[model samples]
Target chain A: MVRWEPGAEGRLQAAALNLYAERGFEQTTTADIAQSVGLTERTFFRYFADKREVLFAGQEHFEQVFLDGVAAAPAGASALDVVASALEAASAYFPDERRQHSRVRYAVISANPGLQERELLKMATLADAMARALQERGVDEAHAVLAAETGTTVFTVSYRRWMAEGEERSLAAVQADTLADLRALVLAAG
Target chain B: MVRWEPGAEGRLQAAALNLYAERGFEQTTTADIAQSVGLTERTFFRYFADKREVLFAGQEHFEQVFLDGVAAAPAGASALDVVASALEAASAYFPDERRQHSRVRYAVISANPGLQERELLKMATLADAMARALQERGVDEAHAVLAAETGTTVFTVSYRRWMAEGEERSLAAVQADTLADLRALVLAAG
Candidate 1:
């Protein structure tokens, strides 16, 4: 017989998200989150460094997915194409079931400057990681950084559209539209 | 008899930047900045909303230059072209004499997460203004936004490159290279 141990981290995160959505991020406490998840406050602290860390727990996973996607891009692709393909792969990792909660969390984070800064830092770190991955794929440093920045820009636009529209379209579609828009903008400028 | 008036805001910003560069953003205080400018603390407050505002006082002027340049772009020019033209015009606004101080200020701001967030907000606002200007010139809203974002991306890349090499190249040349790189990335991707 297999034993079913408590998924303390997942439960704490789910509880924190719910509480944050119901009340607010600033209003919620680690104790409240711990109690809701039926875990001790100590256990909660053991899982997350702080209450805010619960909201950002998936950042590491996001980085890994993006890096792996970039690594797997075709060898002949240009830096931009490689990045776009990686973003497409990363998009598949975000599901519709989680979109509502993600939007709510984003709203909470956006309303707070500190949280917004943390989010930006996280995104910047991700951009750096993508650039490094591109460099490993044989792209030069400057072009690799530009490619990563371009990918981040497209992701930002697509995510904004997705969140604003309640995730009605697939993430891939939104990303594709963003890439096309980028191309058209450049060609028009020329 | 004649009366003399001082540019209080400019003096305060200069003082603040000097302190920030010599010491650091975290080590500097409003009082030190005020004293260095030969003004009372109250006078500094009257000129700026806070210490951070001193560093950002000129952002509006930059935005205006960019918008004006975009508006004056030749007819039938693409959105990217308009944005590139705006960046070129804006580049002329940055004084050669202030390059060293500007570099120091940039380093301080980049090193501080709080300042970085504020900087991002400012850039986002400028991009929004650029998009609005483009829309006023008959471009569609979505396309205008994409164009503005692309332009900002190029400007950022060019500015970073210029800073990276200690301002050896003219801002105009760097801006041109950035636009060319962006266009090439997009075309290669397509």
Candidate 2:
């Protein structure tokens, strides 16, 4: 696979975002993104299948980070505890520096219903992956699914908060707080 | 808007299911469905937007039933209670008689990635609607989101179980059991 020259990926991503935001997503083409980034269209395609994928390219790594966390959770942790550890592990994928890129990506996605639906499907996929990872660790099917789904929910709420225009907290901090809130709400049902 | 005859809707749905099962969702056309039910293509168009919409048409009512429950929850109930109440209300929409229909629909959806993604987005939409309904009842935004998201997760888990092959429990009964399970799991964290 052709990799980006050092720091070139960021330049290409920035150019694509500017173009996608300036011109409508439908009207933009790979050539436009490539030209704007001073890279060949062949180079752009080498990195992403299409212009639309520019927004989704990081999803695999994001999920892998969460799955790694799940796989690395301490043995004997409760299902929810394992999920929490995984969530915290995934948070490192979104550092303080990456927030603006996410905010812009969220903006681009929010404006299009198809993109928003894709975003929802993407989160669901992450939950399924996490559940599978949990099950591999000997968690029962139901417990794995429940823990993963709820963990994904907490992460989504926190990620959205973290991506909010004025919110400044790290995804890890926001997610930690959200998980506690979910626990309190669930415990309240007892 | 044109309406189906007293039994026409059921007949159409049954015929569509048979065709979709035999020919697959992608190969099945709206005309094929209408013809199978001995209705004109015009009648088919009147009831559903497309072949795919036949599987999705009931979603609007499903979300509405849950929202009504949220709206009518006993005054001053806790946020989680309100969500649970809404979930129970929605259960009435899925009686034992509807089980086979759901089973077939779920099969059709699971076999198609596009349909599966749409299903995920639909569930996400339900959660958002539930959250908005909770907020209207004076629950704080954060509490409303956490409760609604978790409630939707529970409902999804229970619904999948209800639709599983050879599963005989009513959606309501299964949901109640699942809700209790979720409560136990959450409480275990304390």
Candidate 3:
């Protein structure tokens, strides 16, 4: 009988992360991850398509959060404002507790070209989704795309800071700060 | 005996594009491309690693144009200004002559997820390189990354416009228009 627990996915992810950190991502196997989680390999496949999916399982959920935030923004909000609100809401998903896990995952991802490619695609997908949401809010395609891309950059830079050692700021705070910096950069260019 | 001649790369690319357009990307084979170009399969391999590479052979040269532009910007130029100049310079590489080829290539790429992932990684790589160049010019890390990413977005939006049917404007013109739109979006959010 297959055992399905309330936190089976989390347990699998935690086990995968731990194994990846200890043995390196390339060295870790699916069976190792499953064994570490005290789950069958069949259960592992049920949650993730492969070992790589464990590291990126949150991408769809995160993209949905960003899209929802954009859709829920005030009707009168500017395109960039809607993106900022969306990024702010999305950042809340990465709490202080996730910093260490994120750091480990980042390291694993950075060392693998395949993982890096997936990461880029995930960000691109998020940007595309956000752009569509902005357009649905009556913004032009040009503005929508720019705002969505800018929002992704803000999230990336802020997330990097939030994951850095000795960095204690929340992801939302860092995102706001980076957004200000981007505004200054834009104004200076203009 | 191999018939090695000048413009072999260009010929191979043209043949690949024609074949891809006719038979679709997945259905076209490297042997067909080689035969169409009147070259041996070995000659095609010498020019491009694989079929997909024929469409992306100029990426390195394009990156060089952008980087050189960044490096040549005035000493007092802001990070964003450097990026703008880089983009302006890079836009010059995609002249009107390449528009049709670009459109066809875009269609082929859009139909394949693997190609889309590769395209996203290529853009990310460009952004990363631009950010590093900005950092080398004394820009702060946050500002550098934001400027680089925004520049990539500008290029993407402008390129799409330039590729659209019935669009006759120069790439530089489209890029300037998109940059203005981005500036307005940023200002509104600010």
Candidate 4:
């Protein structure tokens, strides 16, 4: 029995991150998060399945950004090009405004193996979504899956580089560079 | 305290897998594994940190195989080629004799998100180990990591294909074919 509360979701998420950062993920509980947000436990449950869910609220939205990008890519684009375009579209989801929060989120995830596993599962699920999106665009099943996985790898490497100290380039710029590096590596492999 | 009983480790692993197969991983317990092996719970703990660890007993040995192959690759080999060679060496770890076990192991892993997370962590660790091994062999840090990761992708795709019903190709052969497919896909992308 949960009721809608305007702005409650964002407030709860911010509170959860703060508590997780302050007390570590394992030490943080649902009640603590709800209390910090001035909300009830039932209200928290309305927005998130659990504490971990708060950290991953954007997984589905990010997946949609990626898939929409693939669908809107120029016809006849190479498979990698389509994936790259999808990445480009998805990059907007992590603008400079969110950089500090992203860093804190990444830090919390890295500090907890449970969170890291959840991150892995999210990435794996996104890869599958990307693959299916590619298949919808007429690519073969095997090639679609590979390209999607490779695209996820590209996103991961670029995200790390983008988060590194003194990094000033946009996420899109870093992604383009890493994609080129991957291309060159693959080419040289043959 | 743990005792060094000859054949105890193998017996425990076999028993754990059997139990996991018969009564799902979630339903199976460490005590059940020990009881089936005619050993005390203390002995099971001595062999495995937990029930999930039993499914991952070969992770370290597999990592060693990859690292050893990287160390032995020719000095002039390209980064991807070096990783391919490592995969070739590691292929021996999953010969036909182990196919049934591997299939059962993968099944148990697929059934549990917790196990899937552990599997992802193990794979990530192995990739890092492979990357470090390549760096030691004179490959640049960036190229080493990318090559190692790509090789892991190749291994994963090939292993899945090999495990499919009626697949008769050897692990090494499937790996060779998959590597070639990746090369072609990347070449086409560029």
Tens-place lDDT digits, model 1, residues B1-190: 3223388878888889889878989899999998986788888887789888788887888799998898789988887788888998988876566566668779989877778777777777788899899898899977887778777777776777777744578778888877787778888885
* Sort order, DockQ high to low: 3, 2, 4, 1
Judge candidate 2 at residue A69 and give its lDDT.
90
lDDT of 4 by residue, B1-190 (tens): 5468899999999998899989999898899999987899998888789988888887878899988888777888888888988888888888998898888888888889899888888877888898898888888876777778778877877887778778889999998887777777767764
Q: Give me the candidate number with maximum lDDT.
A: 3
> CA lDDT, every prediction?
0.81, 0.84, 0.87, 0.85
Question: By the DockQ metric, which is better: model 2 or model 4?
Answer: 2
Enumerate the candidates' DockQ scores in order.
0.50, 0.61, 0.72, 0.58
Error at A133, model 1, angstroms: 2.4
Instruction: Give the winner by DockQ.
Output: 3
Tell me how many clashing residue pairs each candidate has. Answer: 2, 0, 0, 0
What would the TM-score be for candidate 4 when compared with the true structure?
0.94
The better candidate by TM-score, 1 or 2, is: 2
A47-148, model 4: which lDDT tens digit per residue?
899999999997878899998889888889888889988999989988978778888899999999889988988888888899998888899977887888
Which segments of candidate 3 are over 4 A away from where they belong? A1-6, B1-5
Residue B139 lDDT in model 1? Answer: 91
Residue-level lDDT of model 1, residues A100-130, one tens digit each, is 8778889888777667767777877788899
Interface Cα RMSD for all candidates? 1.7, 1.7, 1.4, 1.7
TM-score between model 3 and native: 0.92
Ranking by lDDT: 3, 4, 2, 1
B68-184: candidate 2 lDDT, tens digit per residue: 888888888888889889888988998999898788888998898778877887898899999998888898887898899889998998998888888898888888888787776
